[model samples]
Target: MERSRIAVAGASGLIGGALVRALTADGHEVVRLVRGAARAADEVRWDPERGSVDADGLAGCGAVVNLAGAGVGDRRWTPAYKARLRASRVRGTAALAEAVAALPEEVRPRVLLNGSAIGYYGETGGRTVDESAPPGEGFLPGLCVEWEAAAAPAREAGVRTVFARTGLVVARGGGAWGRLFPLFRAGLGGRLGDGRQYWSFIALHDEVAALRHLLDTEGLSGPFNLTAPYPATNREITETMARVLHRPALFAVPAPVLRTVLGEMAGDVLGSARVVPARLLESGFRFAFPRIEEAVRAAL
Candidate 1:
């Protein structure tokens, strides 16, 4: 791949950090978008809350990846927290999109890869969905719709814009998998709810690779579900983790208990989504760990 300067927002995040490392290893110049001020030579100041960013800092970059957002599982889904979630994503994306659009045509980045999630297809039940699927009903789906739309400025400016509809990433240190590793190792791992909810997951390595694919691939725009081809049920995941860790999967978190403890967040935890990476496959991006077993071993 040709080397070029790339500006990345949310550089401190789990996914963002991994992507930065991969990009830097591949000889790309990475400019991190910081919230306060440019503390380092490679850092650029940007305030999503105020919809402000340093346009001068972004000039001549090949791509601008906006991964800035409040974590979904970071806190309870109180009304205020929900608002903050939406604002964090939408505002940051809009700020970057507008900034990219304002740049001179000759210097403007060629692409804008914005962060998104498979939550757009909320509670698919048993149905398998792909990028062609319409947005599901409820808060998460609505938030995703708005989040992707927040990049209108970049799209309208003729910059290739892509929405990474990522799934539950299987990794060692962060994301949902981070919390699961300890419990499973201690023999406290169990299925959530009925253990029938489908989880579309991808290994962290493949997740980062798919993002890089989108960033580099020409003529690729719109949404792409970054998930393994075959999604597994919560029960399957529990069993796999137990077997891999040599622990017992004898416990189960009842639906009522999860609801009581997790509140509105319980819906997402217990909900089902059997998503596939149709566009990613069509684009010829291959996965290193397409199977749940392979992903589990890699995480371990």
Candidate 2:
């Protein structure tokens, strides 16, 4: 593969961190967009609030990836926090999109991979959905609608903008799945709510690979679900974790308890989204761990 200079926002994040290492290992020049002073040679300072970014610094880049956003499930959803979540994504995305647009057309990157989430589809009950499916109901779907629209500037500038609608990333140390490991290993693990809500998941390694795949594959735009091929229900995940860890899965977390603790965010916790990576499949992308057992065991 030809080496290229790629600029990335949110380089401090899990996916962003993984991507930077991968790109560097593959012999690509990776420039990071940082909020504070440029800490290192490859970092560029940018403040989304002031609509400022080192556009000139990004001139020669071959691509840009924006994963800047606050954690949705990180804290209690106060009205203020919700606004922060929206602003963090929409404002940063708008700024990055505009920055990518400001580059001289001839020097502009070939593509812009914007961060998105399967939350765009809301709760899908038991029905399977893919990129072609229309947006579903709830605050998340509406937020996603605005989130993707924020990337219009890049698209208008003739950049191939891709909305990577990510799902639950299963890993050992970070993300939600990581938090569940200890509980399940101690035999205190249990299903959430009815344990029937489908959780579309991807191993962390696969998630990173899929992002790289999107970067290399041309003729692909719009939303692409980054999820494992085989989605498992909450009960399935719980059972698998317990089995893999040699523990007992004998408890259940009721919906009301989750609602009481997580407030509005509980809906998403108990929500069902049977999402599949249809676009990626059609584009010939493959998953490293497609089954729940394999995915859980790998995490352990």
Candidate 3:
């Protein structure tokens, strides 16, 4: 498919920054929606909290991707922080959806790839789940439901809306894996909790590629799991990291310790969601690093 102009919200984030670089390197024009003033040709000011966006800036774009949201693991799960998490995702998505919906048909983007997460499935334990599975219980699941629902305006306006239900992004720089790299390098890395909870992870390289696939593909709409085919247990992941980094995986953080240290967020950290990219695979998307070892090496 030929590259087209795409507008991206949260373009400063890990995935968004990588996506922008990938798109631009491939000759696609990208316009970023920024919270600050538009100081560059590629930037457009937007405030999701106030529900304001420069619609004129969005005009003529072929696609819009809204990845605006608070980093789930960036802080402790205090009531206020949890509220910010919900507000950031739900409000930002709603604002973007409304902006796209208000656009004239001639200039409206064809597709809207809104940000979502596999947390919708809650704690799937050892059981595997695809997009077909219904939502599970808890705060994360409920928050995900609201996050996806906030994009209804775009879908209702006949935009080809898709939810990129992302999994644990295994990257070197910033994410859950970011904290792991230093520890493992110092030979202090170990499994969290019982280390048996399943973790569905994807390489940063494949995550960007999958997003592009969703953006460019035709006749594709709805939720797609952006995860690898194989789901590894936390213990397996620790072993892989140790083997790859030549470190010993001798230590383990018990579940009680995790709860004490991470507070409410510990539940999510230890929760299992054995997710698979069923819809993405069915859509003919291919992953560059599908295995745990490959993904871990790629991150390094």
- Judged by TM-score, which candidate is best? 1
What's the ranking of the predictions by lDDT, best on top? 1, 3, 2
lDDT by residue for model 2 (1-300), tens:
269999998888888888899999999999999999887878888886566787877787899998888888899989998888888888888888898898888889889999999999999989999998999898789889889999999999899999999999888877788789988878889999999999999988888899998999888899999999889999988888888889999999999999999999999999999999998999999888899888887776
Q: Model 1: what TM-score?
A: 0.99
Residue 123 in candidate 1, Cα distance off native in Å: 1.1
Give the range of the ten consecutive residues with the poorest summed lDDT in model 3: 47-56
Candidate 1 residue spans exceeding 4 A from truth = none
Each prediction's whole-model lDDT (CA): 0.94, 0.89, 0.92
TM-score of every model versus the real structure = 0.99, 0.97, 0.98
Query: Model 1, residue 175: displacement in angstroms?
Result: 0.6
Error of 3 at 15 (Å): 0.7
Writing each residue's lDDT as its tens digit, candidate 3 over 262-287 gives 89999998999999999999999989
What 10-residue stretch in candidate 2 is worst by lDDT? 48-57
Please count the clashing residue pairs in each candidate, in the order shown.
0, 0, 0
lDDT of 3: 0.92
Candidate 2 regions off by >4 Å?
none
